[model samples]
Target: MPNPPRLRATALTATAVLLCPLLAGCGGDDPKDPDLTAQKLSWKDCPAPSAPEGGGAAPSPLPNGGRWQCATMKAPRDWSDPKAGTIDVALIRVRASGGKSQRIGSLIFNFGGPGGSGVTGLPAFADDFAELRTRYDLVSFDPRGVGRSAAVECKNAKQLDTYLQVDMTPDDAAEERKLLDGTESFNAACEKNSGAMLPHVRTTDAARDMDLMRQVLGDRKLYYFGISYGTELGGVYAHLFPKNVGRAVFDAVVDPTQNPEQGSLGQAKGFQLALDNYARNCVSMAEGCPVGDTPQDVKNRIAVLLKNLDAKPIPGIPPRKLTQSLATDGILQALYSQELWKYLTQGLYQAYQGDGKVLMLLADSLNGRNENGEYSNLIPANVAISCADDKPRYTVKDVTAKLPEFRAASPLFGDTLAWEMLSCSDWAVPGAAYHPNVSAPGAAPILVIGNTGDPATPYEGASRMVKALGKGVGIELTYKGQGHGAYISGNKCVRNAVDAYLLQGKTPAPGTVCS
Candidate 1:
């Protein structure tokens, strides 16, 4: 709700980065309400979850290669009072078969989103980290309002269907008014339906929940592996309980203090950087690129393509529902992961040929619209989390004033991106004050990773976070790469450096540049 692109990853929606007054400004439930406390958990009391009733054999290896189990542990909704109301945190545990007792401990993985499902990612890294798992239990969970846990379900998935289908970026005043009205309407719906849960969905609250999860897991100190917004979570934990931290790896880190407006501008620039990287590998090559050699050339072509689609929404594959906006959404999604850049290039290439199928598929995937016409809860959760975390900075006048600058920076994606949050400006749940500095002075050495050309979390952000921590080390694994949160995905030099730190408490030598 805040700006879609900026708040997207952090706030449940991954819109844009938004900063606000304070949790108190969220305005719903009383902050002093004793019932809403986040209670910390203790290991001795965190009973091991029950296995499946049938105790059937394990399933086949997963795409990322690992076996997974549904596990649960109880923690109080509020940590300050352990005796308060308890909630069950659904977890996915992937144990390592090779390492055995030498296991270092459990490593909790959070993939940002304040809503992203780390549980679903367990298998993706299972095979590669088999050794690590042998010694340590790899755990991921559905943070509150996320997957599997007591999810905050929006109106029947059908309404969400309608929500995702709406276009937020409009060209004319009439369309613009429609976009603004739609946003306020959606915000109202969430507030009325979600009730008290709306105000309590902040990152700070989520971090507190993580601390409780840590205690329930029975770890004296916490070890974490977080990506994107996950970095914020780890930072918050380190800040709250530095002494309780063990080994923390924050890849694709973000500086929570940044203003969403400036950050979005910076991100647009970062996207340009990534686009340049993609062009280097894509344009002027034998394979062929979707756009032309010059980045401006590509921008011009996309603008044309979007206009064509805007005038006539192409019927995409059955479920993706290919609209111009959806296509843009897909392109942005793939931009987050460079591995998919080729497909985008191919899709763009094909779209230039009047075949919107590939682009539509890519877009569908980005939109998380399944083949069955059912979308993953990604978009809605993205909105819910973001709106709850922060309010949008609005005023038709303010956004209009910045239009020229934004458009100049991003010819193709600028105006659309700028207007992506007309909905959150009037959001019922506003944000709390922005705390620029969130550092863990006494926490164990926290490892911060940054790729020089990361399309998502810019390199500067990682640098800022490391500097702010003051005690932690920033490992510049110059993959000289593009994409988001793929540490341990591949790249031996980078993987080994991270592996050594997690496996053994060895931090990469200062400013170590791997690969």
Candidate 2:
């Protein structure tokens, strides 16, 4: 997989700004030292995101003129061995807009990716949470091995461009070998470039960092908004520090009950469902669908296009070609949000006419490639964190055996996602668990919102997360809608439910349904 499971938030735009360098503190502090928590932070005006942070300008001032502040917190490089060394955890925040008396504490957000840069992500979506900003300081960060926090480096830009183009789905022995070799090469590059950091980027370690962050931020409890993979991190945090959770919301929930294989399979079905929805919606439009006559016809055309591209690639953004993999990835990226359907339609139309630029652009976004052709550390960090968290490493034989089931689930996405099982096969570090432990019995009630049409993380994950979180702790809310997340969909019901809980501590009734 060229990309790991990531949030489908707005695309981050790149711009010029001053660079804020991370000054690594002198290491070798006492393992049991308590001074780190008491260390004061010198917050300053935000700077442009580093190359690893998808390179972007400093966050703009909030509507209320509250400037974004940037800071770095020192955390143990390895939670298991705190005395070893330390790494900087990058953070960004905007203070509450309302008066001091009305302020709750900081509400930290982790917008998924396991690799998404909160320092950049928060700014892009700040307006979406303007209401919450009235009472709580909006906070977010780049977890370790992500963005500028000891970012994991693998292949360079040129090599990455090549790597992403490799045929992910193998039809025969030679192709399977090539796939395996490519995966192994990628993993080896990670080990060569960032071996030490690889073993320490697990979700559990990140959860501990959050607790330390709570102490550093002077918050009595952790009030959090976690999306996509962020929800998994939140669950682990709740499990580790149940008493410290204040108010938490998990949108686009990841099922904690499944292993990596199961998760990938679930995604196959989810994406297929989203595609079906997209096709049906397109045909139902008053202007008539430009892509096809019927929903099945649309899908059939796409399948034919992918098959044709597999045999002979089409010209994309020049020098690069739109291979079957890129087109498939582009299609999956579009499925993340209903709003992107028009683009998908356009991309498909363009591809049919032998121009792959639009589809290639969509694929580029999914791969974290910028217009400059430089990549963010998204792919590296995602693979690093995922490998460190998951244990199972599938072999080619395993994937071959499961192909039929995957295909049945999603003929469009099956082979690619099934082959993605090999992502961790050659990792340097052993994974922490088959699946995360998220049974927080006494934790604060966390609002769990599920979007029925969410492609990346299926709706079924919400109830599974609820059950896994144990009784009375997870309040499930269903949004019968399209897209990857509920709150950002601009749905009043979801927004109100989430806002009321986060802003007023008034939890929505359990089993609430929003449309």
Candidate 3:
């Protein structure tokens, strides 16, 4: 299972394509490189995504006939030492539909994997933001150590296939050793493959890159949209460059206050809440719930299925069996969006019948594996950036000690997540801090949207972010809905409020609630 911090919007989209039809300088003075900043980006037609980017054909044109263009911006490899060598940061954008005078400059987006390729993300969901594109250029990029921006490669496809199958929730000493050995091996692979880029992949370094990107795009202030982990990045950017903040919105807000352990624990509760909601929805449906007669019954059946898989794995995709770990990952993926709920039901129905293809497919999506059996740098970069940003490293004892608390948090997810605390173990680079500092005291009012039922980031994170962003700097908008994000949930109120803020510069009333 992926660490709970990962947001699956882009990955989930990748899954749909397979099933469907074919498809910084450390703070201080702010590094300055006149030549690099003044250099012009040579925007051209985008080519098919590379293997590291989760390979696919180049993005198609927009509905308005505006072509999606790609480019690369140069930035220092290490922000702390601007004099160091440079690296390419891949970018993608489409011009605004509105007249030149009406254009409000570029509106950059970060779809929050810390590892997700904004280059692919912007185009995948371009239609949803077409309105924002009317007045602003829709722009996004592959941050360093992600996608084509000097991607961090680790275990190859074949190796990852085996690594991902290891029992993450080990029950005995031998099983625990296997889990630890696998983790160390994976971490070692990352060091062997991408050691040069490891230390510089921290959030602080990425934040610096964004400021340079702002200057290169000729935008006086950044007009931005961030989701999930992107929210954390945006907050860090705001803190580092409060004066440069423009109209920014953070949806599916991450709590800037929690350390990795607290964040993981919160996800345990959050996902459990979402599961409860999913069960209730299942039983209340007009067609009637097929999985179980009652909410608790549905959960009970799932528990039994998982326990059974742990003991005797079920046949999944050819050559691989659906183990308890993969099944849990598949379930987590389906729970990201309400639209995926039907697929979850279908997967569960098939699993009960001893066919694990659907569930395996879902797990494959989460792990960045496509139908072709190729892997993307998503998981690798996720671990790299997360380890670089998080300070704590766990031991087998640390995880075992916390198992009870984690299981108490969510019998379904606690163990898996607790075990994940060891993801940074034996990492190549030391982490920056316990938690990110998102205190942007003087930044412009950032519209923070939180979904009441968000599983990954949780709703309380909205208020926490608002507080962290400081007085008058953060605006909270509550969306009483489901899913990992609010705006993408297709809620009209959210769209209108966000559109009003980003397009017209009209900040929604603080503490605004949209149901």
The global C-alpha lDDT for each of the candidates, from Candidate 1 onward, is: 0.61, 0.85, 0.85
Q: Where in model 3 is the C-alpha error above 4 Å? A: 2-30
In model 1, the Cα lDDT at residue 265 comes to 62
Q: How much is 207 displaced in model 2, in angstroms?
A: 0.5
Candidate 1 per-residue lDDT over residues 20-73, each given as its tens digit = 001221111212433323334322221222121101133344554555666655
Residue 405, candidate 3: C-alpha displacement in angstroms: 1.4
By TM-score, who's the top model here? Answer: 3
Q: How displaced is residue 79 in candidate 3, in Å?
A: 1.0
Model 2 misplaced stretches (Cα beyond 4 Å): 1-32
Which of 2 and 3 is the better model by lDDT? Answer: 3
Q: Against the true structure, what is each candidate's TM-score?
A: 0.84, 0.95, 0.97
Residue 320 CA displacement from its true place in model 1, Å: 6.3
Task: Report the lDDT tens digits of candidate 2 across residue range 398-461.
Answer: 9889999999999988999988888877789988788998888889999999999988889999
- Summarize candidate 3's per-residue lDDT along 80-136 as a digit string, tens digits: 677879999999999999989989999999987768888877887787898898899
lDDT score at residue 477, model 2, on the 0-100 scale:
100
Error of 1 at 325 (Å): 0.9
